[model samples]
Target: MLTTSTRLKLQNICSRLAQGEFVSLQERVYLQKFAERDRSVSTWVSRAQRFQREGTQQGLDGLMADLDLGRRNPDDPEHPEDDLGDWFSNASPWLRRD
Candidate 1:
């Protein structure tokens, strides 16, 4: 488990990444270290990278929601799987089969 401070710092880095801000090499290395140890952090890092590449906040938001991060609603009763179709359709072209 990540310490609370580390998790907070990671979140800050992710927030900056989502906003198209550049992170320092040291910050990148820090994220890389934690990402290697934590699946969730790895997913977050990948989504942040995708956001940087695609320049689409919607896609990032959807992907993050799928990961149960920054979810807008807890009682909305909508399963994350309910949006899998949309997610797959919006995935990067290289990720698609056709």
Candidate 2:
């Protein structure tokens, strides 16, 4: 959602970085104008990396199966009600004991 001027400035910054240039005075000034946005991008990248690593370790199928099972049927006996601690306490009666 960068403005046209901001996007042009970012493109310039990236081009400079690719050429092994650190922030020059003008680039630094533009960056300061968008410091909060840069910080959020960095934070999101960090979180995404952590999530990717953890998800890979768990396997994609494992993650999907977990998500798929999150929904519970209203008519299912395993549905718990009243006190959460006591909820599903009688699930064995509603589900196959085996």
Candidate 3:
């Protein structure tokens, strides 16, 4: 349901979070813009913002833990394959998706 540009932004945000780096302007914009419509993405954005303000990597670490736990998506039909979550699960926990 996300546009190409938005998808790119999401990918970039996930990458930074995965790397334990701070989120960027474009990533913030993506989160804010999509928060209303996407609960998963919003949750991630909320955690990111909270951890940032608290001055800790707890949120990022938590995200890594979630990734390691793996996840299941009932929304996307093309799953267990090229879906973003599947890609992350198959590859790197640092890489994230929503």
C-alpha lDDT values of all predictions: 0.76, 0.50, 0.60
Off by over 4 Å in 3: 43-98
Per-residue C-alpha lDDT of model 2 across residues 1-98, encoded as one tens digit per residue: 67888766665664454345565878656655665567643333333333333333357655743444322333457854356445556577765343
Per-prediction TM-score to the true structure, in the order listed: 0.56, 0.31, 0.36
**Tens digit of per-residue lDDT, candidate 1, span 1-98:** 99899999998898788678989999989999999999989888867766655465467676765564653333457644256667779889998655
Tens digit of lDDT per residue, candidate 3, span 1-98?
A: 87888767775685566456887777667667787788766666545444443334357656754453332332447654345655577875566554
So what's the TM-score on candidate 1? 0.56
- Single out the weakest 10-residue window by summed lDDT for candidate 2: 41-50
* Ranking of all predicted structures according to TM-score, beginning with the best and ending with the worst: 1, 3, 2
- Native-structure RMSD, model 1: 12.2
* TM-score-best of 2 and 3: 3
Show model 2 residue runs off by greater than 4 Å: 38-98
Candidate with the larger lDDT of 2 and 3: 3
